[model samples]
Target chain A: MKGLKIIVLAKQVPDTRNVGKDAMKADGTVNRAALPAIFNPEDLNALEQALRIKDNYPGTTVTLLTMGPGRAAEIVREGMYRGADKGYLLTDRAFAGSDTLATSYAISCAIKKINFDLIIAGRQAIDGDTAQVGPQVAEKLGLPQVTYAEHVDKIVKNKITIQRRLERGIETVTAPLPCLITVNATAPECRPRNAKHLMKFKHAKTVTELQSAVEDYYKLHEDRPYLRIPELSVLDVEADTNWLGLAGSPTKVKAIENVVFAAKDAKQLTADQKDLDWLMGELVANHTLG
Target chain B: MNNIFVFCEIDEGKIADVSQELLTKGRSLANELKCNLEAIVIGSKLEGIESEIAPYGADTIFVADDKRLEFYLTLPFTTIIVDLFKKQQPQIALFGATSVGRDLGPRVSSALKSGLTADCTSLVIGNHEDKKEGKVYENLLYQIRPAFGGNIIATIINPDCRPQMATVREGVMKKEIINKNHKSKVVAIDVNKVVTDVDFAVEIIERHMEPRKIDIKKSQVIVSGGYGVGSRENFKLLYELAHVLGGEVGASRAAVDAGYVDHARQVGQTGVTVRPKLYIACGISGQVQHTAGMEESAMIISINTDPTAPITKIADYNITGDVSEVVPRLIEAYRKHSK
Candidate 1:
């Protein structure tokens, strides 16, 4: 069987799970500098699914695609260290302030330039948690989508079977190839970076990164073309400037407020026996507890 | 021409509670906007479903009953909803932020080239003034949700989109009946025109929907724990306390993510929003995401080692102690006092 080409979409998001005191600025904006960026948790799950397909199919190839600032190129190399064959950094100033719809349009335009039989992405990025980009991309491409996918059971005769994890129960379904899938976190965790792949890809840099680097690696990059990661700009994908960023986004933020909890007049207590007895007596008297 | 619409979700033969909640919310918004409230249900064997929806103050209900749509398939449902939205030109659209709604809302929004916000905690009708564009939009739907990991709350608005769409989680909005004898007009959609053979390309092979075993939403009292509870073994203490108090056990998103308990018992922004009468939080530091779910409880008792935990601010009673020690003693105290 001729192996299929797969594109795994990923995002470099602030580690929202471990937000510390410095994670937020005084004005209530996110302090991006204080938070370490990591590969979005579920996207790692999506990458694992892609790598598994590459493992099962001898000739299969996995390509990682992400759209963000120049720093997002780190995730592309991160994907290579795990098993992705190649990566693309879709970065441009024109793509700033894009909402989910505008972001998906830019991504769909980029995907059109690549050859792929399947597209896999995380169900949602933790930073946004909207879970809209994957399906929106599929809609823009006019492709079928299966969200909340837990596993890719098999691929036979251009047909793919997948297990989906839903709130109430499990569902197994089958769809033709060239479909988009947004994997859930329940999927197997991605394999750790391989020493060999890491050593090879550790030096890989995007064009923007190479331009800003102080070290002279131009000669080395020329000698080893694989070390140069391709950076696609808005013009490269031929996306209409009108549908690129804030201008194309339909939703606008009206207001933002820092969460402030109203303090209740709480009765203070301790772990002492007298306090515990008083608490129980008060609760039973008020019919709060039986 | 500009009506407020709710895409109702039906599980088995009954309309989901989240859908009813959205309908109740939609009715109030419609009343404020002075527009008719409409509902759309697409499923098979949906006869007489309007009776259930009319009590929520729906002025009109659209039914698209088809055997192929008995179970939700993404493409067909998206096709029908998008087509209806195009013809209806709804001013605002609301969906339950469920597995089905999350999947369908984005696809439909993308197809129609409209904007959609997900998992909003609040919805309000407000005006937006764009200083940059020198434009002012009147009565736009404000989609309020916790953003940046619940560190801040943002209100989103779609100024130019017709059918400003947003999905809200269940239990966040209170479901209320407008009148038991209210009447609503029913319109049958011709599904054959909207969906085609290609829409059913994906086929469900096997399905098993487990009956919900842990419904903490209905529990009057909930004994919840968080990551500060430490381990799965520590969660058993919470369960014991809950059992002794005749309440169900709940957990924070942190506790559930730590594998200390099932996701069903999770009480937080990402999990289930619970408003039990008596909520005893153990070892919960109570991030806004966790507190958003249970802060509305009639009474809150927080037990944490840190005296200044965020939960203490909203709790009616603050017990400064270790969960392990406090929970058992509370159980013992309750046993002695109740007897």
Candidate 2:
């Protein structure tokens, strides 16, 4: 009968699904500039789940929390355009090159600074595909986690029921409030941006963006406090330096190389009748096909 | 004792295939490091589970049988595993990249302050020299996986962490038994000590696990398509070809994302790893993620308009043409030849 305070962990990631010719460099490193950055698909699913809860609970509030470069603030604003009440962008150079564990550590510290009942995040980000952060964060915060969640069935008596989409079938589980859930893409698609919310939050900007603005908007921000999206630094979250970045990350990248398959000296053929017939004959002779 | 530990997962009354696969891998890695291979199974009514794991050459098997753990709740499983691992001090810990493993591995790793790599394609014993630290570490587990959307292969190492943890997808590793009569030292864990009342904060209300309806992994012959297949209607051609050839139809991740086919039929790193006898890849530019699943097929035939498509390099036969044009011809040719 009461509203819930929820935090949706979102990310801005490169659209890896449609990698282009310019996606990779000559030496096999990622050409990030060439790739388009978009809100992570699964995170959008998680946001939708959070928004649905807010929709059902009349007084509920949804907040978006994202950790990335200043550009990731765009997702926070995007979340607002989709019914989120507010958002915080956690950005700091000290938080760079964090593996899942260190990333979760920093995120957990930030979550502690905020007041929330439930935390929702995508199962995994496309860029890393680790699916480790949600559970890791839950562990760091001493909370239970339900992963691969397809639907949040209901909330009653401070308990949340979720339908999880496992490899084989479906499972329904219940966890108390102040827990975490990681949503899967199999859930419903996120609702489209609202025209009214979009018009209202279009000018929302992080501190960094405000500093780099071509025009002076200090007076405007002072007048409209809601337009000032909070940007949290490592110190703002009270995270230790040793556990914030690459230093805190236990996993080290030993090596990275372009994917190169061993050439098998394939016999080249065309679509001509002769080539097709010959290929079929060879396959039939070898019992490769009926 | 520093040993290699595998968190063997159980479904119903049997050990999961991925768990057995990891046990097989953990055994070999233990052999290479000259350490003991250990396995931990946490569930209810798991009395004779050790019999299944002993053949994998595990020197020790830890069983924590309790009703609370029969269904995997993240907290309880993590509590049991983290406690055991803290005492055992395993050098390497492995888990399947299944739903349960992915949920439990990171929690345990976080609790123990360890590193965890997910969906690793290969695990090898190697050495790493930290130039910055000026330290050379030997016999590290090389957690090799496809990174950045399968564009590159990254080998990760946890130089300063204990129980270097990693999760591997099912069907990625080969499962073999060392000896049928091998015996293992069984250790029973006190569930009440490791798992407390707080661990049961989550409750399972209902569960329905269905048998896999479309299992492409067991298909002997596969006709797979990709984004280049163009449209959902075009996928019908692949289905027809597969039907005529008495094979199954598979789709790449791109095709599945495009709504051309169901995700169940996807063949790629995020999907199923299949080793069919004959694989016909139609209009699929071979991304490593897609190839990782089907590269080991007995024979591969790639049909793409692009001559330099990466899939061609690994294909035994490269047919340069459109799928629409090439597939029908192959189907006709096969029909005529077979008759």
Candidate 3:
């Protein structure tokens, strides 16, 4: 029997957890460059899940995909160094400043160009924590989504069994294959980078990807392979131009505000009978209790 | 008139209480906008669910009932919600940031190609002068959420989208009073997706349902263990206290990681955020990331060996004593009081 085909969705994010002079701004948008860019921690956990399944199932091919600026090719290449059979980087100038909807539209377009038996993503991105893009991509792809997944327990021939962690407890559910899952950190920690695999993909850059390498080589040795990321036009991924990036995205930001959290000096609602009566009345009056 | 669309979360045929809380908030938002509020429930066997929503202030109930939706897999649920937005455009949409909701809200809004703000802590009506008169909203939708690790609040607006959406954390608001037989219209939207069109090949096997564990997020009373609880096994004191209070067991993320309980019960940035009525923090030194989740409790009491524990700063009452001793006493007090 052939192994499962798993594809992981990963994002390159500013390591916001790295607190330094460069992490925050005077106005509060993240100082993207102050912190080094790293693969999202949860997305790494997502990648690890795919790798573990491959290790257990054997014959599995794991593919990783991302859509971002050219720098994201490094994250995909890093995934390739982690046992991913192939990595697709959808790097283009047009995909910048995308909100969740626009980002999902672009990634979904990219996924359509590949065949996969399973799709996985982190539950939420660390920077935004909106937790929207994964499910949004699943919706655009018209796939079943099992979110807040903490562990993958068993796999029958065509049915997949897994544990979904909820606020209260865990629910074991069985569903058919070809679904999307957004995993949480409670899943297994990501495996460390492998050495041999890293060496194999170190030279695995596209022609465009190697262009920068040549420039850097010109600067240093001027002899080594010049590397530049492969920049895919919307046509390269077979994506409909009408439905990619901002043009295909429908949601638009109306405004953005910075809110300050100030603790209020609140009086306690007493447990006395008189206080209880007043509280009950207040609850009912406020439509909290009837 | 402007109408608010409330996404009422139903898990295993039961309506999640957080969605009811959202209805209460939505009702007020709808009133502030001077429009009707519709409670949207998607699931199978949803006949009596609408009866329980009206007291919370729903004027109309939208149901997308189907067997495929019996379990929440994003596809079927997101499709129905998008269909509703297309058919009956509402000015504002609100959802609970539960596992299902946090996943579903964005997908539906995006599918309809609209905007959504996630993990919102509050919402208000903005001036609708931007829209021409006779439009759905009196002004605009003001979506608010805690951003930057819950340190900063952000109010985001989607001026172009029909229904500006937000997903709020649980217990941030009080649940609306539901009148059993309030009169409301139930509209069934026929939203369907094919089984074969999905690209992700995932399978579901037997669900190894975790035996019923305490759900601290929904509990009105929580007996929580903190760092001073000493060891993971010492969490039994929290369970004893919770049993006496007829409440649920909870913990600081520290306690959960100290091997005191399963990670599912961890409460903090990466764990569940809860707002119970009475939160008893025993032996905890409250950090911002941890307190950000539980700060909204109705009444908070801090018990720590150290009088200067950070939790004491915000606690309504403080008991400075060893949690190993104080928790047992609190349990005894609850047991005697209840009996």
What overall lDDT goes with each candidate model? Answer: 0.90, 0.89, 0.71
In lDDT terms, how accurate is model 3?
A: 0.71
Candidate 1 stretches greater than 4 Å from native: A18-34, A261-290, B215-339
lDDT per residue (tens digit) for residues A1-290 in model 3: 36898889998887655545545555344556666788988898899888988988889998888776667788887887777877778876566556788778888888887888889999887778989998888878877788888888767786777788876567776667787888998998888778988775676665565565644433332333322234565777666555555445544333434332222442343233443344334322322111
Give one digit per residue, the lDDT tens place, for model 1 in B285-330: 9899999888888789999999999998989999999999999999
lDDT of 2 by residue, A24-45 (tens): 6553335556778999999999
Query: Model 2 RMSD to the real structure?
Result: 9.4
> Which should have the higher lDDT, number 1 or number 2?
1
CAPRI classification of candidate 2: acceptable
Q: Whose TM-score is higher: candidate 2's or candidate 3's?
A: 2
Q: Residues A98-179, candidate 1, lDDT per residue (tens digit)?
A: 8999999999999999999999999999988999999999999999999999999999998899999998899999998899
lDDT of 2 by residue, B67-122 (tens): 87788888888888988998999999999998999999999999999999998977
TM-score of 3: 0.70
The clash count for each model shown is 0, 0, 33
